[model samples]
Target: MLARVRRNGGTAEEFIGRSGPGVQARVPVVTSEGANKVQDVRFVGLDGPGWLLRGTITGTGAVPGSTDAWSCGMRLVGR
Candidate 1:
């Protein structure tokens, strides 16, 4: 899974175990007109449940290891 980040020229580092080793990556998203945009991405997979949650934050203030958006996501996903 980490390879997916490296393949896009981004680095993937393991989380601090707050959510069971979630993935942190800052990857580039290519635009239609031959442009590149860097995006902060995080992914957490549910063990033994075949479920995965992926999040991407863009625009200003988007960064790796940030939890604001993730918190919002969890709320949307429910408890």
Candidate 2:
């Protein structure tokens, strides 16, 4: 799973939130000038029988821009 949060400092500004899911053995983060940033998310899940992966993203704010997104995926190695 991977998630991110971003906010703008103005009233009329905006905030965004994102999330997703995947099979990953490791997550990497990079830092520079005392700030941490996400480098990347690597998916390492192997394809096998009944393997499933899913993800969802949601956001809310004062404005009507709030929304949500969902997705699902699966694999059947042998059926």
Q: Which number leads on TM-score? A: 1
- lDDT of the candidates, in the order given: 0.61, 0.29
Model 2 root mean square deviation, Cα atoms: 12.1
**Best-matching candidate per lDDT:** 1
Q: Model 2, range 6-58, lDDT digits (tens) per residue?
A: 22211121223332223221223345677654332223233346865433221
All models, RMSD in angstroms? 3.9, 12.1
For candidate 1, write residues 1-79 as lDDT tens digits. Answer: 7898899798888774344546777887888898997777666544336765555435442455455644323432343
lDDT of 2: 0.29
Consecutive 10-residue window with the lowest summed lDDT within model 1: 70-79
Q: Each candidate's TM vs. the true structure?
A: 0.59, 0.20
